[model samples]
Target chain A: MNLLHYLRALRGIATRELLRFVHQRERFISALVRPLVWLFIFAAGFRSTLGLSPIPPYETYILYEEYITPGLIGMIQLFNGMQSSLSMVYDREMGNMRTLLISPLPRWFLLVAKLLAGTLVSILQAYAFLLVAWVYDVRTPLEGYLDLLPALLLSGLMLGALGLLLSSFIEQLENFAGVMNFVIFPMFFMSTALYPLWKLQESSDLLHTLAEYNPFSQAVELIRFALYGQFNIYACVYTLSSLILFLSAAVIGYNPSKGMMQKKGGKQ
Target chain B: MIQSIAPVLSVQNISLAYGEKLALDNVSFSVHSGECRILLGPNGAGKSSLFSLITRLYDTRQGSIDIAGLNLKRHSSKALGRLGVVFQQPTLDMDLSVERNLFYHADLHGLGRKQAKDRIQEELERQAMFERRHEKVRQLNGGHRRRVEIARALLHKPDLLLLDEPTVGLDMPSRKAIVEYVHQLTADHKIAVLWATHLVDEIFETDQLIVLHKGTIRFQGSVPQLLDTTATSSVASAFQHLTKEVR
Candidate 1:
């Protein structure tokens, strides 16, 4: 595609995603509520029962409420990314996907533009959560804001790529709900969202090792380190690698000539 | 099939299946420039599958489709660019303003801001939606939304247009208006039109008609040829007879 045409295509797909989010008020609010529910209610209930342990990035045991902020932020991006792809499946059923797939630009570019738009939305939601955290007096270094931007972007892209990968393979929209049961919850709970690796290591070594290797855990770690104005090389590497890997897999999964989606969705 | 100077669209022995269920069986037909081909079929008759193949929505298991001389598998996006499609479902964004929806489609076609604005204005006027341009799609009636879709489809000046059961649910007047307008466009613009519908009255005597049944083309000829004999006086009756005979 020519440069001018490419820009317009990107603009079109991006704007469509944004407009969809804006139009669906209940959906946007629900996305925010899921993270907030964990932060205010669930986190509060577990705050007292949880024994304080010195988490790595922390010099001393900190409040459970404060410790989980980064995890909540990661959770928001993860769920929103999946939601974006789920909507793509919905769009396909509704016939809107046909409009997009028929556009005279490379389908990969269009899909990437969609992922970028989802990341934008996730980042915006994360910022809103940050504002609430600040009000709760969960303080971080001033430099943390600057450091966290790139980390948040990387995490967003990583999660967005995963969502695209899922969208490419799932045959029907009904199967997406099953993904939440089988994939989403497991990934979120097995990661370092609620507790650090050291804490999990004491409870179960195998589980701790699994969490440490989970790419999502690395994403959460990257965000956690950046939130405290620290650099995390391991997290950075893992997140980048996952981003490339998921995107490549999604591209292969969506190859129109030989993709399974044609076999599944080609019928009337 | 009769030869033409240059066929705008062609399908060659295309067969599509959904696992054990076949959706299209060796369906082949060609429509030349300026002709209107109405694919008449009942529900589950594989008309929609043919539309999907022509638009390259899914790869055919057996056969090929070409649009404006470009093979679908080789040049899908380019082929789609030359074809405008309005599916049975309304694809416009309901929350955005009508004009905004048109602008988004213009961008999809890679039109510049100035050119898109000009073309949007022209298309809206053509569909008499210029006055309601600022209204949100959620507020518009069903017929108006369909008009917006048709207007959006025309933005790229396509070589061929496909309307898959475009007026599936609409008041009689609204359906008549769309039918008349599409017929006018086919003649005026000389763009080959493939209008898929089940209604017999929608098929004109001059328009080429094809009867699709169980994923295959049962009969393809003018309305009169298909309605030649046996109590099958109307196109719908003829279609029912052909499909029943196949069973």
Candidate 2:
């Protein structure tokens, strides 16, 4: 295909996603409310009990809200990614996906376009959350706002790829809610989103190990460092590798011949 | 009509299976330009499987399919570029205006902005939907939605159009309107159509017919020829006569 054609397809797909997001006012509100509730009510309850040791980014101990801000940003992306995948399943059932797949473009390119669109939406939601955090006085360094852009984008793509992979395997919409709860809860609770690794270790050795290995924790750390205008090499490596891995799996899962959907008796 | 013109769609001995169960067993057919061919089959006669294969939704494992002189397997982009499809299920984005939905399809086909707008306007006006172009698809009746889908499918001017049971849930009048529209397209635009459905009423006496049952073609000819072969007076009884052994 011509380069102009590919570019046009990308633009069309992205614009369609943005239009859908705009129409679903309730979805946007709920995406914000979930993280805002945690930032306000949950952080308020834990503020007194939680203590932080001086870390590289933090010269001194920080407030609970500041500490959890990156995690909640990560939360917004995580949920948005899963929500986009839920819509993919809905699209498949509703037949809109058939219209998309029948286009002359390569299937992988179409899927990546979808992934990029979802990531873009998640990033927009992350920025909205950041603005809300700023309004709540849980502000980062002013320069850190720009620095966090790349980190937030990478995290959104990684998490959205995970959602794409999950949607390809999920058979029905009713089954997706359970899968979302299983995935979102563990990935959030076990990560450093709400608690530091050392805190997890103090709670249990298994929890500490799980937190260390959790890709979500690495994503949060990447954002945490970027929000302070610093780089965490380990976090960057882990997040990039996970993004590649999940994205490849998603592409494979959407393949018409050997994909999970084909194997599961989709539209035969 | 030029007698030497190549068929718009040529399927050669395509066979498909899901594991050990055969879904389409060496099915083959061709539709020449300006012809409207009907693939008449019951719900489980593998009509959908054949469409899936032709559309490349499923792989062609045992045979080849050619669209407008391009092989589906080797030259998929060129082949698919010449094809249009309206699936059994409604594929419109309910939240978007009808015009926006058509624009998306146009962009996917790589039409430039000006060209896409012109084609979209022409197709919508032809389909009698230009007045309702700003309305969300959810607000339209089922028949109007199907018309919009057909308009979207034609935006790229594909030479071959495939409709997989397009009238499954429509009322009698709506069904008649769509069928008549497609018939008119072949006469006016010289576009080849493969219209798959089990409904006998949709088939005209002069149209070509392929009757598939249990993953094989029981008959392939005109409606009159099918009636003559079965010694039956109507398409319905001829279909029953042809499939009764398998049933």
Candidate 3:
């Protein structure tokens, strides 16, 4: 209704999310550990096996860890997005979601606020991943850390929206693990998260195009460039548009009159 | 009791279906200030479905719902602003303290900080939950948690309290306490109540009743009128007589 109400609601929702994140120590540790595993073992193993050419974000050849840092950052956001939506599905089953939906605020505003809060939390995880990576010698320009804030937020928003969209379609929390595997593995492997588009092209033309076109790859590129204090207009625009598209679809999927809630309520 | 005043909640001709199966059909009811309207029904009698429509968890397809003179579809914020709901299931985040839950709900209703704190204290104190405010909801028993939820629902001082089977799983004393508390709300304060339940023992002499069965209203009137029509001496027999007719 009033600005004060809207602001307070957003604050409460966001704070709830933070409190949940803090309470789930295993989740926070696992979120960071998943990415750290790749940096310590996966990248360390690939340092000699994988070769790299100079990329837009880099002036000279870089090691595998350096190359995968941005991708790993992307990985953190990607997982955080899905995991937050996973919690949403869990909440719906538990009825906390009903408490939220019944509030006087517009549904769209609530969903957006939810998406934003999830994205912010994911951004925090990404920074944590970045911090660990930086100490591990995956260093970039100091200003890169500051400049990449907007990029991470946008990328996190897009990924979180995608997760929110998937959550709306999922009926049971039990069905979500399979869906996450189906989505996460393909989206991660097909993108430039593990390797560059050129490397994919060297292996196969089709894989090249898929990686090049993948939204996750664009997100990776955006992070990579921004980490070096550089700008890539194409990646920025692509990620932003993907954010809009996914967010709009998520909003639609959550609409009570037309969306998933219209199904019979033998269970709410 | 403010029986002469306009109804705080009015539902007119609300219908709902899931594809081919009708969940609720042509359901209409109203709740005036100081009135407690009980929606009595069997398990599959579409009680949850109707509550969903009222809470806007799902919207009505065939009719309109108005709360405090505001149409729910067009003016949802204003309409919902007048409603407080405690769902069939416990909805408080188990990880968050009781105070946090109430504060979050108050914020959603636009209560200012000092005002929200005051109201939270008042409602919690009323429910005998103020001493346990800082405890996580998980620490409370089923009855205590329900009390906290009731306190949270009242933070905004809504005109209509919509409770969906709030005492379904509680022990006898807890159930009696909740029933007494809610009845006192309508008796002392002018707030209206729409309580959905299958438990015949929970009904009071002053309470109005709606007997719903298989997606339709079987009967709607005061307890005496229900007794006259069903020719039953007690609430239990009357409920069984009304519900078992079509079966």
Candidate 4:
């Protein structure tokens, strides 16, 4: 339980994750391609056709590409979190996770270390994506860059925790593709990923309410507010509360006594 | 063995199940410091399941497990600290050098860089892997990779070591070398060993043997005691005779 001890463990976990990113050169590049494809290809096609009312935060006419920059960053965090969790499940199947599980550390500490490690990687990807956006003229406040770190870290942790929770219950790794279709796509698209929640309200009242209450929407708004150099109390509260809830669920899901992972004797 | 040796680990009537499917039923065994106990069983005989329960990789619904007089459930991290386990599969990273692989493990155990460096050197030397420490595991032979795993397990100086099918893919000589090395550790360092495997050849005459079948302990005793009445002389032949008779 020593602080130095767990910090060392956290470093190991983070280093291991970074190594995976290094070895799989193609995977590292492909992770960026998915979000860019959504930005460059899909967003470009929809920019002229989509009608936009004035966004509250927008002082002037903002390009759709600039408006969606925060959402794309959120997209990168969300997918990267799921991919990290998928890798964990893959490790469980491949026996690497057993190495972590069998370590002589408290399970809760191990869980937190893993979450922080994954979140660190997710934030790295998000920053890299933001750099690409900057070149493309997707402008935000100069100080916005400094303010976005905590928002990105919290959103990454919350999404990673949710992914970890799902991993504990996922029957098999093959089911992960199904989860992308069911859990991830809906969470991203049904939220304010491409447009504001208020903008969705013009289309359908039911969709607006769903978007307003969505945890994913809260994450997007938190990051969006931070990206614009503004503080939104409700978004910050919602993001932090969801982070706590998801992290608690993830910890409980990995509990050796009751978690679905406890069934160790079944076929690997 | 010490003149007055105490048991390093004790398991009493531990039974485990998955819903209604029983995985281990009333399993009990013990090993004193400096002793080696071999678990001989066929597939689905609960050898791996027993390892899982002992390591607390999974919890048990029934019975108690104590390591160095501490209950496993009450002081899991403390109890687990005394245990070093080599799984049935290769768990080391293929891309990382042997040293880096062990370094990652040392960090997980919370050892400082200097301390971990010293321990890693000592352990790799103990397993005769120091020469190959800088080589990526993928470049090494299967036998050498397993040696790296053994070295990794020993980094923390665990009191009890559990190896589940540790020599699954190694050649005969490599397997024998590992077996002899572990035997030497038990004698020289007074470390307890739980070596689980289906191959009865892994069980030496001096070692205690447990025969697990269908999630139950079919037999447990010294190799001599188990084979004394049989006409066969080797542990493998004795196992064949006993299991055949039971069947």
Candidate 5:
């Protein structure tokens, strides 16, 4: 395909995703509501009990809600990422994916278009949640907003790629709930989304080690630092590498010859 | 001397398997422009598998496939670009309007906005759905939805059109309508058609037919030739006789 055609395909696919998101108003509401509830109810409940030593970016101690704001943004994107994969599973079952796969574009290009589209949606959700947080008095510096853009995009891509990788392995929509329980919940809970790495270390060495290696933790840390206009190189490298690994796995899984979807005994 | 036109679709020695169970064994066929080739088979006869191979939904381990002279393996984009497909399942985005669905397909094919709009208008009008173009696909009946899908497939102006059981679940009139429309597409547009179905009534005596059974081609020839070989008066009886003999 020519450049114009590639651009058109990207625009069409992305616009379709946006249109689907718009029609499903409840999805937007619930995506925003889930984190806000955590920001308000969970954070408020834990605020008094939790104590923090001044972390590097902060000169003084921070409120629990303020500390967890970036994590909540990551949470919003993580859920949206999985939700997009759920739609992909539905698309496969409904045969819409076949139509997409039949497009003249290279399969990888098509997948990248889909991943980018999902990431765009997640970014929109992240910004909306940030706006709500700002209104609720969990304010970040003005420059931090600009810095958060790239972090939000990278984090979104990482989580979205993970979702794509999972979707490629998941054959049926009926089994997605199990994945949500086993994968989503574990990835969210085991990561530093809810607590700092130091807190996990204080609790258990094993848990701390797990959190330290978690890609989701890397993503949350990336966003957390970016929200304060700070760059975390370790988190950046970790998240970028994870994005490439998961995305390559997803692309392979969707390959008709060698991927997970390939029929055994079929020509490789 | 007249020069022969190349076949729009050519599948040679294509084989597929699902682990130990063979789905297709050394299947081969070709369809030329303006020809309607019916891949007639009963359920589990590897009709879908063959369609999948031709459409590149699955790869061929043993053979090669070419679309409008473009090698599928070596020039996938060009090969795929020359063909349009309608799968056995309904593929329309139910939430999108009929027009939007066609528009999306046109965009996927790289058609510009103006050209896509014009082609969408023409196809919808041709399908007698122009009046309802703005309606969501979910609002349309099965036949209309199938028609919309056909329109979407044709927006790219493919030289070959692959339809896998395009009339599976429709009423008799709807089924008849789709069959006739596709036949008309072959004749009027000179589009090669590979239509896979198990229904005996869908086959016409003049059309090319390939009888597939249990992952192999039981017969490949004109419908009349099939009857001649099976010593049966009708295509249905011939189909039964051939498949039974193979078993």
Candidate 6:
């Protein structure tokens, strides 16, 4: 209704998420641990076998840890976005989403606000993961940490918007495992999260083109450049456009009158 | 009989269809301030579909609904602001404390901090739940949880209160308490209520009743009028006599 009203509602929605996140210690632990295990165990083993030439963000050849750090950060956000969407699915199933949907606020605004709340949580996780990566000697220039903030915000929103898009389509909680298999794995593996596009090209031109076009790859590239205190206009533009595309589709998909989620949930 | 100076809730020629199946056909109702109008129907009698229409969970394809004089389609914010709902299923976050849940709802409605606090306290105290405000909702029994939901719904001081089978699973004592409390609410606050239920025993003598069967209204009037028309001695028999055409 007013600016203050909007602010208050956003604060409430974000605070509810924070409270829920705090209560789920297992969730926080799992989110953090998933990325770390890859950084430590997976990257450690791959570091020797996966020698890389200097990528755009990298001036010299780097270890697999450095190469995959941005990928892992992308991984954190990718999973966080889906995790947030999973919560939305859970809320719909549990009837809590109806409470949110019934709020006097505009539904698009509520959903966008929900998307933003999830981005905030994922950013926190990104920074925590960065902290651990720094401890592992995958250090960025000191200013890169500050520079990474906005990048994390942008990439986080894109991935969270993707999650919003997915949550809008997913009807039940039981379909979560299937979504992870279909959405998460393909997006992660087919992207530059673990390797550069050129490397994929050396292996397979088809996979290389796919990785180059992958929005997750662009998000990782965006983060990869930012952490080195550089800016990739291409990655920035690609990621932003993808975010807009995903968010628009998500908002439309959630409309009661026209969207695919027209069937009321929780009664079943 | 349900109309007042102006209806708090007005549903005009509302019909809902799921593919070829008509869930509601030209159903219409209005509730004025201080009126408790019951939508009595067996399962799949279009009660949920109608509630979905009122709540804007589904689009109003063939009709319009106005709440507190604001069109739900054109001015949903204002209309929704004047509405309070306790859905059929539990919607509270099990991990959040009672006050936390209520406060979050208040925030969603954009209630100011002081106003939210005061209303939360008043509503919780009214439900005899102020003492347990710090307790998690998961700790509350089914009846108590329902009470908390009712309290939360009333906190906004809505002009129209829609309860979709709020007492479905409660024990008799709890159900009776909620029924009595809601009746008092409309009386004391002049709020219009649309309570959907299948159980006949939950009906109060003064309440206006509408019996729905197969997506159409079978009967709607006073209890005595229902008996008079059906030539039956009791509400249950009258309901049976009215809906006996089910095949």
Clashes by residue pair, model 5: none
TM-score of 1: 0.94
* Lowest lDDT block of 10, candidate 3 chain B: B1-10
Off by over 4 Å in 2: A266-268, B1-3
lDDT of 6 by residue, B1-247 (tens): 5343889999998887787788888888788899999999988888988887888877857989999999999998889989999999999999999999998899888899999999999999988999999999999999999999998888788999999999988899999999999999889999999999998988888988999988898888989898899998999898878777738
- lDDT string, candidate 4, B1-247, tens digits: 3336557888999998877888899998888888899989888788888888888878877999988777899998888888888999889988888888998999998899999999999998877888888888999998888888888888899899999999998999999999999999999999999999988777776898888888888778887777775667877877777666454
Residue-wise C-alpha lDDT for candidate 3, range B1-247, written one tens digit per residue: 3357678999999998877788899999899988999999999899999988888888766999999989998998889899999999999989999999988898888888899999999999999889999999999999999999988888899999999999999999999999999999999988999999999999999899999998999999899999999899998899998888545
Docking class of 1: medium
Tens digit of lDDT per residue, candidate 6, span A156-240? 9999999999998888899999999998999999999897787888899999888889999999999999999999999999999
Q: What lDDT does candidate 1 reach at residue B46?
A: 88
Candidate 5: docking tier: medium
Which scores better on lDDT, 1 or 3? 3
Worst 10-residue lDDT window for candidate 1 chain B reads B229-238
Q: Best by DockQ, which number?
A: 3
Error of 2 at B58 (Å): 1.8
- Residue A234 deviation, candidate 6, in Å? 1.1
Q: Name the runs in model 6 displaced over 4 angstroms.
A: A263-267, B1-4
True contacts kept of each: 0.68, 0.66, 0.82, 0.72, 0.73, 0.76
lDDT of model 6, residue A233: 95
lDDT of 4 by residue, A111-140 (tens): 888888888888888888888877877779
Off by over 4 Å in 1: A48-56, A59-61, A266-268, B1-4, B229-233
- Report the Cα lDDT for residue B83, model 6: 91
Model 5 chain B: which ten-residue window has the lowest total lDDT?
B1-10
For candidate 6, the lDDT comes to 0.90
Residue by residue across B1-247, what tens digits does model 5's lDDT show?
A: 1228778888889888787788999888889999999998888889878877777777756889999999998888889999899888999988889988888898889999999999999998998999999999999999999999999899999999999999988999989989999999999999999999989888766689999999999998887788889898999998888777534
